[model samples]
Target chain A: MYQTNQLADATINKSESAVDVQPDLNQYLMAVASHQDKAAFAKLFAFFAPKIKAFGLKQFRQEALAMDLVQETMSLVWRKAQLYSPEKGKASTWVFTIMRNYSFDMLRKIQHNKEDNLSDDLWPLYEEAEPEPDYEDDHLMREQLIQGLEALPPKQKEVVEAIYLKEMTHQELAEHLGVPLGTIKSRLRLGLEKLKEKMELHND
Target chain B: MIKHHPESTMIHAFVAGELPASLSIAVSAHLELCPHCKAIADKATKAMADEFSGNEALVELAEPTPAQPVDEFATMLAAITEQPTDAPALKSAAVESSNQMALGEKTYTLPRALRQFSQTKWSGLGNIQRARLGLDEGDVHASLLQIDADSAIPHHTHKGYELTLLLDGCFEDESGRYEKGDFIILNGEHHHSPYTAEGCLCYTVSNAPLHFTSGVSKLLNPIGRFLY
Candidate 1:
């Protein structure tokens, strides 16, 4: 169960065509983590370029800002690849983190210019893992994670989905749910804590 | 351990990037060794990742579009290498404040730094040794009151108002348990038979000394007046 989810960090879309050129996801990550592997780099670029662009477009609300964020996020991946721990998170989450950080930078920039602090209420800043210069495994420990999430109660699932997927902070989720900030946090904590208990057994 | 506080909204500050860096790293190290925290983190992170992926459709259908690449961002990859590790910086001498060690709690700290007058002044009271810290602050007048955690201060109420933020362990009165980071607000209407559980340390700020409702203990009110 754990081995399967391990591959999650790779950009290999379970639905998309499998990336064939590499020995495995981990190996591929380590090999091209440095700027030297242009072939691997090109492959990665093809995978993330559009995702980054789309990611930025959502946040900046302008084509140019989105492109800049995309470019910056990818470039950051290029440098930090060595720091990416295959054990920490999936590839998509990592890249998402970079874009998220870029968004935060934009928020700070907005604040510096005396603009409204919209990001002020946003919590849960997810970070991207850098490209790993060394990944020894091809498998991922994700099945446990997936199964755990599937087991959550509907309301808990909804809360998790809204806050995490929608990028709404706890405060934002609270406003949307018409609940107290404490209630939102309690839901998040309780939901995740239950999932964690189930996952620990599966991972073990 | 299930911390059953009615208000124990313990979000992984680590996940939120809001925790101090060293603490976050410490938690990460623990995650690698203890599947407990890791699985917890994994569930949160994976759920979050899935949520974001699903939202891709909604975002694509909207908007005037984002800006193009800027020179600062273009150089981001290179910049990541030069940036320092996201580790929290721990100063050499972190515990210099007037926080005193309560006897029964085994150990308690004076807050780190800001107490520069050689040593704290410990005055003896019944069954407990009290310490006076001249460390003053805004609305809350700061002082270090160390009582044997096992011993209870005689019943007392405030003349003004008082605020206490717990720093070490739990302290319980008629109100409830106060763990670390617990900020307790008490006014003249409040009276507590406060005692530390297994002994604890509390950083207290009071605008005035406490006034006893009824007791020969009311005699302390005169001194509490000058102290407050």
Candidate 2:
């Protein structure tokens, strides 16, 4: 009973009023990183925990494991908050990267019991070599991304959601959606191109 | 210059954590050297985050079951917040030394992603040398393969899938010539003999043994199982 239409409508509304609420996220992260502010941490948890749980459920498809992912991801966020650099990317993108990496690590561990060899030190952490374009406009990027998602045609949005949120392979997505593989690929390519264009326009 | 790069779909797969661990490592190494792919990957990740947030209300809440489970969340929170006793050592080690491995008189710097496995020793086979990278235990095999200049690998097809990331120099095969930072992925359907003119180093990951397709090199087919 996931309401795709309602979710899209809510996101579209959120995008319209995003400017007032966006800066606070980056500020809260900075507060937690600089002072270990419990109040800020709680605020971050309240905002991200449920979203991460949704992400985990989408990935693991098990409530228990998804909860574990939320716990692990938030805990890492608390410990590594100092590593957050405003110069690199947006607060949401940084948190998303951590959650994604943690989810991948957990999935890998479950599939194979080689935990001893697959230590955290061995995994390549996200390290960008070049300075990201429009780093200072991270909030703008986040707002534009939501607006862009709202702008996609229904079919394109579905394709993008299956690939990004559900982590579905093209073959799997094609089978699930009852579409030809070529159609799925084209939808996804078109969706991403539109998103890129929207973000670029916002940067200017 | 990198003449070839990983396709956008592959990068999306990598970002989504759908790729196998070995292939993920190879792509990570390639990303370190290829900025174009890196930029695309960054955008893909941001888009994914935004998409997830868009569907925020749909995520179900975890309900506590009455089984007397330890408060895992509390335990995790405490574990992460606690300062590690080895913090100093970890801090010093964080500044990774430039890792360079030498083959004969030629030396090449390893990509940051591959530097962690530099301690493993390289084993030689004819003009080719390889070092198996131990990544916990899994069916997928990953290694560094270095072929001397003008050397040719026996013509072969993969049993499963093979992903190669050129770390240095150049090589030519049926597809095209691959330069540094090139990502080459092959499957059971492909058959090619790769030869390098200026020598080449690659990070390769394979799920199954390569089946030799041609001449006297076919005699080494049985050994190909262990070669990768």
Candidate 3:
């Protein structure tokens, strides 16, 4: 079971048809977001409610709780549709995140008898991941990093070298250099600022 | 270096939202500090989404009839559309506050998962201080544990499972040194005294209390519930 799940995780949905499905859903979601288009929302609800219910049933194993999960999650989708951005992820992923969160909170309520809604606190729906750069931008950044490394002062350069080049964690580097962790952090901060400046300067 | 991590199966379960909050928060805190684990979590989440997307055929089999009929869907949509969307309450990611804890003169930045219990007070004995998170996980307990510099925790083993994610500084046990972002899960078979040179803060969750193993520390076994 574990091996299958791990294998499934490794093989992401890369098919063209699978890729094609996301944009259409994104459009429907956008329609719902821009205008309170009930038709667009209805489409989403029709598509997602069963899946959410299916997921909830697997997790909760009780019929009423599963139904409640569907209601709560769909209602949330209706309300929070505007927050969805294609840059963040596909529409299905967004809905899955919401469904799983509700499922988690419901379990907490039932098992622990804790009424506090801690799901959002643990996994903030609005929080976005750091924007990923495409391959070209990555190459450009590497070039800038080399130039940036050259421009750094000896002390700051060593910290950046150890961190980015050698992939040494701040704690490890501190221990390696026999310096306080605070000293390593300060050097890293300064070094990072210089690197960012170099990148921005190259861009300009 | 982060030598220890939660198992891959654990990460999958975490992404699937199968773990209890007590255990989930420990993973969340570790993910905040470990980019490697974060990448794995992101992939798992994506795969979960794909699974849901692809399960339309299976969903039909599992769910023979629509739970909510087409007509009721319209009603729910109308009701939902009528409601005002809530603005996000906490901009936790961008708006940083003093979500930190002090162990003596030095303060360490608490992870986002722990920010909720930032105000909890600390109680201590000797070179150790602990703040319970008040998570209602039955037998399970979650806490922020602080070890003062040049101090050693009594040699002990877990009764069930103990998951400790180092939030700051470093500590070494008989097995190895654990630094920030290390996710170390110890079972009953493992027994060691953790000592730190610069002191450290950790988010620890355990299903059962510690069993002090040796000498004078064995006296602490009776009060282990309070200490763990």
Query: Looking at model 1 chain A, which ten-residue stretch has the lowest summed lDDT?
Result: A117-126
Question: Weakest 10 consecutive residues, lDDT, candidate 3 chain A?
Answer: A1-10
Q: Across all candidates, what is each one's fraction of true contacts kept?
A: 0.05, 0.19, 0.39
Worst 10 contiguous positions by lDDT, candidate 1 chain B: B1-10
Rank candidates by DockQ, best first: 3, 2, 1
What is candidate 1's lDDT per residue for A120-194, written digit by digit as tens? 112222223211222113324555665677789877876776666445556545644668988888788888889
Output the better candidate (1/3) by DockQ.
Answer: 3
Instruction: Give the residue spans of candidate 3 off by over 4 A.
Output: A1-20, A128-204, B55-70, B87-98, B102-104
Considering TM-score, where higher is better, how would the candidates rank from best to worst? 3, 2, 1
State residue B201's C-alpha deviation in candidate 3, in Å: 0.5
Ranking by lDDT: 3, 2, 1
Q: What TM-score would candidate 2 get against the native?
A: 0.69
| Most TM-score-accurate candidate | 3
Candidate 2: where are CA atoms >4 Å away? A1-20, A61-64, A116-204, B55-98, B136-138
Once model 1 is optimally superposed onto the true structure by TM-score, how far is the C-alpha of residue B71 displaced, in angstroms? 16
Classified by CAPRI criteria, candidate 1 counts as incorrect
lDDT top scorer: 3
Tens digits of per-residue lDDT for model 2, B20-103? 777777777777777667778878987986775553322122334678575555444445556332222343355455667776
- TM-score (2 decimals) of chain A in model 3: 0.56
